[model samples]
Target: MQVTESGADLLALLRELDDPQWLEWPTSYDRSAVAARFGELVARLEGDFGVPCVAEQDTQDSSEYGRATVPAEATVCGTRIVVCVSKFGSLALVCAENPGAYLGTQDAQEEGELDDADLASVERALVELGFTVVPEELVESDYDGPSRAHLYGQRPTWWDRFFGTF
Candidate 1:
Protein backbone atom coordinates (compact mmCIF):
# COMPACT_ATOMS: atom_id res chain seq x y z
CA MET A 1 0.00 0.00 0.00
CA GLN A 2 1.02 3.62 -0.51
CA VAL A 3 1.74 5.11 2.87
CA THR A 4 1.40 8.86 2.67
CA GLU A 5 2.26 9.75 6.26
CA SER A 6 4.81 8.51 8.72
CA GLY A 7 3.53 6.30 11.50
CA ALA A 8 4.45 9.01 13.98
CA ASP A 9 2.56 11.65 12.07
CA LEU A 10 -0.35 9.29 11.74
CA LEU A 11 -0.26 8.69 15.46
CA ALA A 12 -0.32 12.39 16.18
CA LEU A 13 -3.22 12.83 13.80
CA LEU A 14 -4.97 10.02 15.58
CA ARG A 15 -4.48 11.82 18.87
CA GLU A 16 -5.94 14.88 17.24
CA LEU A 17 -8.98 12.92 16.19
CA ASP A 18 -9.22 11.65 19.73
CA ASP A 19 -9.91 15.15 20.99
CA PRO A 20 -13.41 15.54 22.44
CA GLN A 21 -13.40 19.09 21.13
CA TRP A 22 -12.53 18.08 17.60
CA LEU A 23 -15.30 17.38 15.14
CA GLU A 24 -15.86 16.98 11.41
CA TRP A 25 -14.63 14.48 8.86
CA PRO A 26 -11.02 13.47 8.92
CA THR A 27 -8.57 15.98 7.57
CA SER A 28 -6.74 15.38 4.31
CA TYR A 29 -3.80 14.15 6.31
CA ASP A 30 -6.03 11.58 8.00
CA ARG A 31 -7.80 10.60 4.82
CA SER A 32 -4.51 10.24 3.05
CA ALA A 33 -3.31 7.84 5.66
CA VAL A 34 -6.48 5.75 5.47
CA ALA A 35 -6.55 5.74 1.70
CA ALA A 36 -3.00 4.55 1.61
CA ARG A 37 -3.42 1.75 4.10
CA PHE A 38 -6.94 0.62 3.31
CA GLY A 39 -5.96 -2.11 0.90
CA GLU A 40 -3.40 -3.82 3.09
CA LEU A 41 -5.77 -3.54 6.05
CA VAL A 42 -8.63 -5.16 4.15
CA ALA A 43 -6.28 -7.85 2.92
CA ARG A 44 -5.22 -8.69 6.43
CA LEU A 45 -8.80 -8.58 7.62
CA GLU A 46 -9.98 -10.98 4.95
CA GLY A 47 -6.81 -13.02 4.82
CA ASP A 48 -4.42 -13.29 7.74
CA PHE A 49 -6.99 -12.23 10.34
CA GLY A 50 -9.81 -14.45 9.03
CA VAL A 51 -12.25 -11.56 9.38
CA PRO A 52 -14.31 -10.67 6.31
CA CYS A 53 -15.11 -6.97 6.18
CA VAL A 54 -15.28 -3.83 4.03
CA ALA A 55 -14.99 -0.09 4.62
CA GLU A 56 -17.60 2.58 3.97
CA GLN A 57 -15.55 5.33 2.36
CA ASP A 58 -18.46 7.58 1.45
CA THR A 59 -19.20 8.87 4.89
CA GLN A 60 -19.09 12.66 4.53
CA ASP A 61 -19.83 13.45 8.15
CA SER A 62 -19.90 11.79 11.54
CA SER A 63 -23.74 11.79 11.77
CA GLU A 64 -24.53 9.80 8.66
CA TYR A 65 -26.83 6.84 9.18
CA GLY A 66 -24.03 4.44 8.17
CA ARG A 67 -20.92 6.07 9.66
CA ALA A 68 -19.03 2.79 9.66
CA THR A 69 -16.60 3.15 9.33
CA VAL A 70 -15.03 6.23 8.77
CA PRO A 71 -13.83 2.06 8.90
CA ALA A 72 -15.10 -2.37 10.67
CA GLU A 73 -16.56 -6.48 10.61
CA ALA A 74 -15.73 -9.88 10.70
CA THR A 75 -16.38 -12.95 12.77
CA VAL A 76 -13.52 -14.32 14.80
CA CYS A 77 -14.34 -17.78 15.96
CA GLY A 78 -17.99 -17.67 17.09
CA THR A 79 -17.97 -14.03 18.02
CA ARG A 80 -19.28 -11.41 15.67
CA ILE A 81 -16.97 -8.39 15.70
CA VAL A 82 -16.89 -4.93 14.22
CA VAL A 83 -13.54 -3.40 13.36
CA CYS A 84 -13.47 0.37 12.97
CA VAL A 85 -10.29 1.75 11.35
CA SER A 86 -10.09 5.50 11.60
CA LYS A 87 -8.61 7.73 8.93
CA PHE A 88 -5.69 8.56 11.16
CA GLY A 89 -4.87 4.87 11.76
CA SER A 90 -6.31 4.26 15.24
CA LEU A 91 -8.16 0.98 15.25
CA ALA A 92 -11.12 -0.20 17.35
CA LEU A 93 -12.33 -3.78 17.52
CA VAL A 94 -15.56 -4.59 19.29
CA CYS A 95 -18.06 -7.41 19.77
CA ALA A 96 -21.37 -7.30 17.98
CA GLU A 97 -24.54 -8.76 19.49
CA ASN A 98 -26.57 -8.60 16.28
CA PRO A 99 -25.51 -9.83 12.91
CA GLY A 100 -25.46 -7.14 10.22
CA ALA A 101 -26.71 -4.57 12.68
CA TYR A 102 -24.39 -1.68 13.49
CA LEU A 103 -22.98 -1.90 16.99
CA GLY A 104 -21.67 1.65 16.82
CA THR A 105 -17.99 0.91 16.30
CA GLN A 106 -17.23 4.61 16.38
CA ASP A 107 -14.24 5.34 18.68
CA ALA A 108 -15.32 3.05 21.49
CA GLN A 109 -13.23 -0.05 21.55
CA GLU A 110 -13.47 -0.06 25.32
CA GLU A 111 -16.86 -1.70 24.98
CA GLY A 112 -15.20 -4.37 22.89
CA GLU A 113 -15.17 -7.68 24.63
CA LEU A 114 -13.07 -10.37 23.01
CA ASP A 115 -11.03 -13.42 23.87
CA ASP A 116 -7.65 -12.23 25.15
CA ALA A 117 -5.59 -14.39 22.89
CA ASP A 118 -7.79 -13.60 19.96
CA LEU A 119 -7.52 -9.89 20.58
CA ALA A 120 -3.78 -10.13 21.00
CA SER A 121 -3.28 -11.83 17.67
CA VAL A 122 -5.50 -9.22 16.04
CA GLU A 123 -3.58 -6.34 17.63
CA ARG A 124 -0.31 -7.91 16.57
CA ALA A 125 -1.52 -8.05 13.02
CA LEU A 126 -2.67 -4.46 13.22
CA VAL A 127 0.70 -3.32 14.49
CA GLU A 128 2.34 -5.15 11.66
CA LEU A 129 -0.11 -3.49 9.31
CA GLY A 130 1.20 -0.11 10.58
CA PHE A 131 -1.84 0.90 12.55
CA THR A 132 -1.75 2.89 15.79
CA VAL A 133 -3.28 0.16 17.86
CA VAL A 134 -5.27 0.77 21.01
CA PRO A 135 -4.38 -1.13 24.17
CA GLU A 136 -6.12 -4.44 24.74
CA GLU A 137 -7.00 -3.34 28.25
CA LEU A 138 -9.06 -0.58 26.70
CA VAL A 139 -11.31 -3.23 25.28
CA GLU A 140 -14.06 -4.53 27.52
CA SER A 141 -13.30 -1.60 29.79
CA ASP A 142 -15.20 1.07 31.66
CA TYR A 143 -13.40 4.01 30.14
CA ASP A 144 -14.88 7.43 30.90
CA GLY A 145 -12.23 9.51 29.25
CA PRO A 146 -12.84 12.57 27.11
CA SER A 147 -15.20 11.53 24.39
CA ARG A 148 -17.20 13.30 21.72
CA ALA A 149 -18.70 16.14 23.71
CA HIS A 150 -21.32 17.10 21.19
CA LEU A 151 -22.98 16.03 18.01
CA TYR A 152 -24.29 18.54 15.51
CA GLY A 153 -24.70 21.86 17.31
CA GLN A 154 -26.33 20.42 20.41
CA ARG A 155 -24.68 18.89 23.43
CA PRO A 156 -25.42 15.22 23.98
CA THR A 157 -27.03 13.97 27.13
CA TRP A 158 -25.06 11.77 29.53
CA TRP A 159 -26.38 8.73 27.69
CA ASP A 160 -25.01 9.96 24.38
CA ARG A 161 -21.36 10.10 25.30
CA PHE A 162 -18.95 8.37 22.94
CA PHE A 163 -21.61 7.56 20.40
CA GLY A 164 -23.91 6.15 23.04
CA THR A 165 -21.80 3.17 23.98
CA PHE A 166 -24.68 1.80 26.03
Candidate 2:
Protein backbone atom coordinates (compact mmCIF):
# COMPACT_ATOMS: atom_id res chain seq x y z
CA MET A 1 0.00 0.00 0.00
CA GLN A 2 1.35 3.44 -0.91
CA VAL A 3 1.57 5.57 2.25
CA THR A 4 3.03 8.77 0.87
CA GLU A 5 0.45 11.03 -0.73
CA SER A 6 0.61 14.13 -2.91
CA GLY A 7 0.06 17.62 -1.48
CA ALA A 8 -3.50 17.93 -2.68
CA ASP A 9 -4.32 14.38 -1.60
CA LEU A 10 -2.74 14.95 1.81
CA LEU A 11 -4.64 18.19 2.20
CA ALA A 12 -7.85 16.38 1.38
CA LEU A 13 -6.91 13.75 3.96
CA LEU A 14 -6.30 16.48 6.50
CA ARG A 15 -9.72 17.91 5.85
CA GLU A 16 -11.30 14.54 6.56
CA LEU A 17 -9.14 13.75 9.56
CA ASP A 18 -10.96 14.40 12.84
CA ASP A 19 -8.59 12.56 15.16
CA PRO A 20 -6.68 14.89 17.46
CA GLN A 21 -3.95 12.29 17.61
CA TRP A 22 -3.15 13.12 14.02
CA LEU A 23 -1.14 16.11 15.18
CA GLU A 24 0.36 14.59 18.31
CA TRP A 25 3.99 13.51 18.27
CA PRO A 26 3.62 9.74 18.05
CA THR A 27 7.06 8.76 19.43
CA SER A 28 10.16 10.57 20.63
CA TYR A 29 11.88 9.15 17.55
CA ASP A 30 9.48 11.06 15.34
CA ARG A 31 11.37 14.31 15.72
CA SER A 32 13.67 13.36 12.90
CA ALA A 33 10.67 12.47 10.79
CA VAL A 34 9.18 15.87 11.48
CA ALA A 35 12.41 17.61 10.58
CA ALA A 36 12.69 15.61 7.38
CA ARG A 37 9.14 16.58 6.49
CA PHE A 38 10.00 20.19 7.22
CA GLY A 39 13.09 20.00 5.02
CA GLU A 40 11.04 18.57 2.14
CA LEU A 41 8.55 21.41 2.45
CA VAL A 42 11.36 23.92 2.51
CA ALA A 43 12.63 22.54 -0.78
CA ARG A 44 9.15 22.83 -2.28
CA LEU A 45 8.80 26.34 -0.89
CA GLU A 46 11.96 27.41 -2.69
CA GLY A 47 11.93 25.32 -5.83
CA ASP A 48 8.28 24.88 -6.76
CA PHE A 49 6.85 28.04 -5.16
CA GLY A 50 9.78 30.33 -6.00
CA VAL A 51 10.34 31.26 -2.35
CA PRO A 52 13.88 31.91 -1.13
CA CYS A 53 14.43 29.53 1.79
CA VAL A 54 16.96 29.70 4.58
CA ALA A 55 17.14 27.20 7.41
CA GLU A 56 18.98 27.69 10.73
CA GLN A 57 19.31 24.88 13.21
CA ASP A 58 20.45 25.77 16.72
CA THR A 59 22.12 22.40 17.20
CA GLN A 60 21.99 18.86 15.90
CA ASP A 61 20.70 17.49 19.20
CA SER A 62 18.15 20.25 19.34
CA SER A 63 17.08 19.30 15.86
CA GLU A 64 16.90 15.59 16.61
CA TYR A 65 15.18 15.46 20.01
CA GLY A 66 14.06 18.87 21.16
CA ARG A 67 11.52 21.17 19.51
CA ALA A 68 13.71 21.36 16.39
CA THR A 69 14.74 24.96 15.98
CA VAL A 70 14.27 25.16 12.24
CA PRO A 71 13.76 28.82 11.48
CA ALA A 72 13.28 28.90 7.73
CA GLU A 73 12.94 31.83 5.37
CA ALA A 74 10.56 31.66 2.41
CA THR A 75 8.58 33.79 0.02
CA VAL A 76 5.37 31.95 -0.95
CA CYS A 77 3.18 33.64 -3.53
CA GLY A 78 4.73 37.07 -2.98
CA THR A 79 4.67 36.79 0.80
CA ARG A 80 8.05 36.66 2.47
CA ILE A 81 7.39 34.24 5.30
CA VAL A 82 9.33 33.17 8.39
CA VAL A 83 8.63 29.49 8.78
CA CYS A 84 9.72 28.47 12.25
CA VAL A 85 8.98 25.71 14.69
CA SER A 86 9.00 27.73 17.90
CA LYS A 87 10.68 26.29 21.02
CA PHE A 88 7.22 25.17 21.82
CA GLY A 89 5.58 23.14 19.04
CA SER A 90 3.89 26.08 17.40
CA LEU A 91 4.74 25.76 13.73
CA ALA A 92 4.18 29.37 12.68
CA LEU A 93 4.62 30.50 9.07
CA VAL A 94 4.14 34.23 9.54
CA CYS A 95 4.65 36.89 6.94
CA ALA A 96 8.04 38.53 7.52
CA GLU A 97 6.69 42.05 7.49
CA ASN A 98 6.63 42.82 11.20
CA PRO A 99 6.23 40.04 13.73
CA GLY A 100 6.42 41.95 17.00
CA ALA A 101 8.17 45.20 17.86
CA TYR A 102 10.14 43.82 20.81
CA LEU A 103 9.24 40.14 21.21
CA GLY A 104 9.09 39.11 17.52
CA THR A 105 11.97 37.54 15.61
CA GLN A 106 14.56 39.93 14.23
CA ASP A 107 14.39 38.39 10.74
CA ALA A 108 10.80 39.58 10.22
CA GLN A 109 12.05 42.86 8.79
CA GLU A 110 12.54 41.21 5.42
CA GLU A 111 9.19 42.28 3.99
CA GLY A 112 7.25 41.00 0.96
CA GLU A 113 3.92 41.51 -0.81
CA LEU A 114 1.93 38.70 0.83
CA ASP A 115 -1.70 39.62 1.36
CA ASP A 116 -4.64 37.94 3.12
CA ALA A 117 -5.26 35.41 0.35
CA ASP A 118 -1.58 34.57 0.31
CA LEU A 119 -1.74 34.09 4.05
CA ALA A 120 -4.56 31.56 3.63
CA SER A 121 -2.46 29.76 1.06
CA VAL A 122 0.40 29.65 3.51
CA GLU A 123 -1.94 28.27 6.19
CA ARG A 124 -3.00 25.50 3.81
CA ALA A 125 0.64 24.72 3.18
CA LEU A 126 1.19 24.47 6.93
CA VAL A 127 -1.80 22.17 7.35
CA GLU A 128 -0.44 20.01 4.57
CA LEU A 129 2.84 19.81 6.54
CA GLY A 130 1.06 18.21 9.55
CA PHE A 131 0.72 21.25 11.83
CA THR A 132 -2.44 21.98 13.79
CA VAL A 133 -1.95 25.76 13.65
CA VAL A 134 -4.38 26.50 16.43
CA PRO A 135 -5.31 30.07 17.08
CA GLU A 136 -3.96 31.30 20.40
CA GLU A 137 -5.17 34.32 22.30
CA LEU A 138 -2.38 36.80 22.92
CA VAL A 139 -1.53 36.78 26.60
CA GLU A 140 -0.09 39.72 28.52
CA SER A 141 3.46 39.14 29.68
CA ASP A 142 3.87 38.43 33.38
CA TYR A 143 7.27 40.15 33.49
CA ASP A 144 5.55 43.43 34.22
CA GLY A 145 7.77 44.90 36.94
CA PRO A 146 11.11 45.54 35.20
CA SER A 147 11.77 43.24 32.31
CA ARG A 148 8.68 44.59 30.66
CA ALA A 149 9.75 48.07 31.68
CA HIS A 150 13.18 47.54 30.18
CA LEU A 151 11.84 45.97 27.03
CA TYR A 152 8.87 48.24 26.34
CA GLY A 153 9.28 51.19 28.71
CA GLN A 154 6.30 50.20 30.82
CA ARG A 155 7.69 51.90 33.95
CA PRO A 156 9.25 49.79 36.69
CA THR A 157 7.24 48.73 39.69
CA TRP A 158 8.24 47.37 43.12
CA TRP A 159 10.51 44.59 41.81
CA ASP A 160 13.14 44.52 39.08
CA ARG A 161 11.57 41.49 37.27
CA PHE A 162 14.40 39.32 35.86
CA PHE A 163 17.33 40.53 37.95
CA GLY A 164 17.50 42.79 40.98
CA THR A 165 16.92 46.50 40.51
CA PHE A 166 19.96 48.44 39.34
TM of each candidate vs. truth: 0.49, 0.43
Q: After superposition, how far is residue 31 of candidate 1 from its true place, in Å?
A: 2.2
- Per-residue lDDT tens digits for candidate 2, residues 82-159, read 544422242332434423322322232233344444455545666677654422111112333212423333543211
Q: On residues 7-45, what C-alpha lDDT tens digit does candidate 1 reach at each position?
A: 456444444555464443423345555555655665665
For candidate 2, the 10 contiguous residues with the lowest summed lDDT are 157-166
Task: For model 2, name the residue pairs that clash.
Answer: none
Which window of ten consecutive residues has the lowest lDDT sum in model 1?
63-72
Runs of candidate 2 with Cα error greater than 4 angstroms are: 1-29, 58-79, 87-90, 101-113, 134-166
lDDT of 1 at 94: 33
Model 1: what TM-score? 0.49
